[model samples]
Target: MENANVLIVFVSAILLFCIAFSRLITKAGIPVLVFFIFAGMIMGSEGAGGIYFDNASAASSIGNFALCYIIFAGGMATSWKSAREVLLPGALLSTAGVMITAILVGVAAHFLLGLTLMQGLLLGSVVSCTDAASVFSILRSNNMNLKAPLAPLLELESSSNDPAAYMLTITIISLMKSDGGGFFGYALMFVMQLAVGAGLGFAFGFAGALLINRIRLNSDGLYPVVAATIASFVFAAVQLMRGNGLLGVYIAAMVMGNVKLVHKTSLVRFFDGFSWLMQILVFVTLGLLVFPSQLRAVWLPALVMSAALMFLIRPAAVFITLSGFKYPLKAKLFVSWVGLRGASSIVFATYALTEGIQNADTIFNMVFFISLTSVIIQGSMLTPVASMLGQLDKEDKTLVSRSFTDYEEDIQGTLYELRVVRGSKAVGMAVSDMKFPESVRIMLIKRGESTIAPTGKTLIKEGDTLMVTTGKTEALLALKERLALV
Candidate 1:
């Protein structure tokens, strides 16, 4: 009980400090996640707080769980519409690009770190892919409105790449422990693990979405809880089966997000807030797991590897993989800089520790140090990079100038997002009696930060944004019916 209380107070103080000084930190071009982790280090085992936490197992478990939550949230956050074009390229990049990155960096690490080839590969495997929590947090906070392919590409890559990295790391760790093994056996296991993980993730994601849609509770507060709980389950079940829990969680979120689920908007809001909470929890806990005293042993190697990742390995991967993609040099450079490692690298470092590999502590400390440097040095400069590339704030002008080139030429009826006018009408009418033409359907309504799919019995209230899709002939009639101004 005493420990729990101290934990709460310590976390609360750090969170308060973060909130109070977020703006100043951003201006300094330092990502706040780095500071959150640093705060944990200061108040943790090595710092003045004297917490004495060194449980790699516990840290790994929480970090993995937090990652599941983060990935699933990313899945739910994906727009099936925007994802259409970028799907193939992104998936290819995630799986194949990860393979190339690990191999390339592993070779580089072998010579640079003077370790066994397997150890170098293991290090590469752990940090090869981008970490989602860091990328998502920075992108959203900075409000970097990327073009279609750019946004979805990054989103898809980070969300899906981890399972591959995990599989590679474990395989190499096993090889290191067992003094290497038969290629065929390892290949079989690898293929089975990936197939099972992807398959389960898809099934659970779809099923969970359907289940969420069917469960209509009497109380609104219970809704978010139910959705969040189910998302966690989606992750746990798949992972328990040795499948890809991250993939499963994300797939589940995508289903719930797009399909007409009960309180879709509420679910989005709830998960988003929960994701932020998880981010705080993740960084803090992982931060506490590090001991400053032990890091000095590996600081030289840490600096060497960090330098290689920044100047050579990362740029090489970007240039090689994205050779055919139409991204300008500036965008490519920004992409290279923004591969900020955060909790996931730290978590993978913990995974390495649990595997009992030689130099495990060195890997953990090196990754922890590198993650800090990446977020602090590269992440906070995202806005400036975007501004340099001229990609920042392009959306404001695009919104004004966008045309419905894909819509009907003639207004038989129009799909419009309606903001209910005060004193005009639609105050308390049952939707069925509103006399909106049969051609028109009030597809969805955004009311006071909540999105609702209205049925015939649903009430039409003022100050609501009704997304009504209908025919051209009934357009005026629908407006008249809404306003009762006929």
Candidate 2:
């Protein structure tokens, strides 16, 4: 009981500190994830806190669960309209680009670390995927709005490429274990994983959306619960069928996100916050699993591999895979530099460790070092690099400017606060009865201590605070004057 209490207190304290410290870190132009991991390291056994934790299996489990939501949230937040523009290129980067990167990094590792082809490939595959959390964090933190398709391209690639890297990692591990699978067998497995995952993802996503819209639950809060359940179920079901669960979750989210559903704005907000919490949990847990002291042994090789990945391997993959596309040289170079390996790599490395592969500890240490350095270096330089490449979209402010839902038209407007005063004609009237301007939207209603999503039938009581949005400044002024008359 005492131990459990201590554990609770420690975990909560760390979360509080991270939450409080995040704003400052973001302002400093550092990746918040780096700070989350560093916090875990500070509280580890070798650090001042002396909390001993070395559970690879546990870390893997937590990481997988966190990644499911993170990916789903990312997919939900993505705009299919924007994503479709870069679909072909993004697909190549997520699939062929990942494979090429893994192969190149594998070859480099084979030479640099004196490892076998398979072992080197295993290490390469572990860190192959560009982390969604890291990319999203850095881009959003820096408020970077890349020019045209670059932002969507990078976002799509990072969120979707994990399944490919995961497939590679698992395949390499199985081949190492059995020494049996030929090239044909490996290719077949990879194809099957993607096909099954994509098929089931589309099926479940549409089905889930239909179910949510048709089944009108009593409480608004339960909508997000249903969505959460669907996200987890899709992942588990896909994995059960030997498909790529991560891919399934992401595709499922994208499908559902595009479809109209209940309380979508609230649901998006909920999942967005939940995914951030998950990222913190995953990073901290993985941080606790590592001993910083062990990293020294693999530091040199890790540094070399990290440099190769950033400069040679990632660039080659981007340039080669994107050769058929019409992207400019600056765009390709920027994409290459933005490839920041992060929590996902360490999570995949944990899987390798749990499987008891040869030199698993060394692989984990090397991956940890590589991920840390990649995030710190590439993450910090993202804004400057984008600026230098002339890719920054100065006109756009939001990371995701497009709407993900069918109902929310034009999310890029100015928000206004309006209060319902006593004796106002609008009081005791339903929101639908107001006949507000078409360009205006009632986003939220704050009544006393409770906030409400104002539906058409919702009554506008006196003393209610309405959070509204207008597409133009003139529309906002018109709304206020009209509200005063009401």
Candidate 3:
């Protein structure tokens, strides 16, 4: 027990260092998630740290929790206005499209590697869903514009596909382990899982929101904390009822995020950071759970499966499902390329490991390798590749931007004051001329706090709080780099 604290501290320190390093390399477009996991591998039992952790149960639970945070955030970030146009196609893709991808990959795996149909499908199902965190983060970060409903379609696709893939994976694993099970039984199980999960998630999410709306806490911060509990409870309740709790959580959060609620910005910020933390932990811990030595044995088969997935299976799946859709070749190509296997794949591997399935260790290691390769290769190139495919461009600002009124947002901005100093470069320059990096918006310079509005002609003075709206980091950086201000 005494050494436990020491181990925790050591692991935590490694995580912090990896996170810092990841941030430093964002310019290279490699996601921070990839870095966190790789750092875990370097510190694992096979590596220098000599930490042997084969606790499949523990890893699975953590992975599930991490996925919940991710799904909730994805839902919150989605806009109803944008989501409406994509709903029809999105549903079709999540249900029908996911099945198609799984089948194609399964077929390829069977033919190429001579694996059984079920085994092929399991591998296919594992990587079918586009990673929710990776998709949302990259799309928003690059400000990639989709053709009208197409953006929302992809967002919804990524958000909802997890449930179906997860169902298939679990059911197949069960059937494999069972003495016997007919086709009708398998179908019934799948339908039951989907219906139950959706029903429970909706009920819990709606009820939670109703309860939360009435609770006027002393502090506004309580709202987010309450919502966090709501998310977890909604997921747990659904899972306990033999439903797809993961899917339920996402739908519930999407509804909540779109509701007319107070403190929206604060809520978004809270979830964004929370989801990031979850992703870091999920990826890193999953990495440590893998043993590198067994990986060599699985190398041949894993690579065979990967090639079929990357080239043959994914493209076939995309083409079949998108048959009637108006998506261009570029969008289709980009979509096929970005079908990453991240947290969910790792979780599925955990499932395989825990069930005492055949070759579980080898499968886990193989998956860990594939996930690393996919995220680093596909994840790092998402922006560039999308840009090349004409699906994304650097000139775009953001898909989601907030509009501010003269009073409301401005009044809020004044609370975070910005000042123009005497002899400051901004003094003589026209508000537009100085080219402020969208950080500070000049509101009003006060000779005193009584309220004096600054017009376009307003001059600057030292020791005056400029009453400008600015991004915290941006404002500080601007002051240091451009104005030499403290």
TM-score of each: 0.79, 0.84, 0.81
List clash counts for every candidate, in order.
9, 0, 2
Task: Put down candidate 1 lDDT per residue, 188-291, tens digits, no spaces.
Answer: 87787787777887777677777766777789899888877887787788778977676667767776666666666557766777877787788888888899
Looking at model 3, report the run of 10 residues with the lowest lDDT sum.
401-410
Largest lDDT belongs to which candidate? Answer: 2
**Structure candidate 3, residue pairs in collision:** 418-466, 419-466
lDDT of 3 at 441: 61
In order, the Cα lDDT scores of the candidates are: 0.73, 0.85, 0.72
Per-residue lDDT of candidate 3, residues 1-486 (tens digit): 878888788888888887667645554555667777777777789987778877999999999888888888777776766677667767777888788877887787778767788777777777777777666655554445544444666677787788888888898788888888576798897899889988877777677777777888999879999999988988888888888888899888877776656666577778989999898888888878877777788788787777667777677777777878887888788778867767778788788888888766766776777766776677678777776877753333224221000111223332355565566666555444555554566555555534445444345556566555655665656654586443
Q: Pick the winner on TM-score between candidates 1 and 3.
A: 3
Assess the local accuracy of residue 399 in candidate 1 as a C-alpha lDDT between 0 and 100.
Answer: 17
Off by over 4 Å in 3: 1-6, 140-151, 393-486
1 or 2: which has the higher lDDT? Answer: 2
Itemize residue pairs with steric clashes in candidate 1.
Answer: 197-244, 201-248, 205-252, 411-472, 412-471, 412-472, 412-473, 413-471, 413-472
Number of the candidate with higher lDDT, 2 or 3: 2
Residue-level error in angstroms, candidate 3, position 337? 1.4
Q: Could you tell me how far off, in angstroms, the CA of residue 209 lies in candidate 3 after the best superposition? A: 1.5
Candidate 3 TM-score versus the reference: 0.81
CA displacement after TM-score superposition, residue 42 of candidate 2 (Å): 1.9
Q: What is residue 367's positional error in candidate 2, in angstroms?
A: 0.6
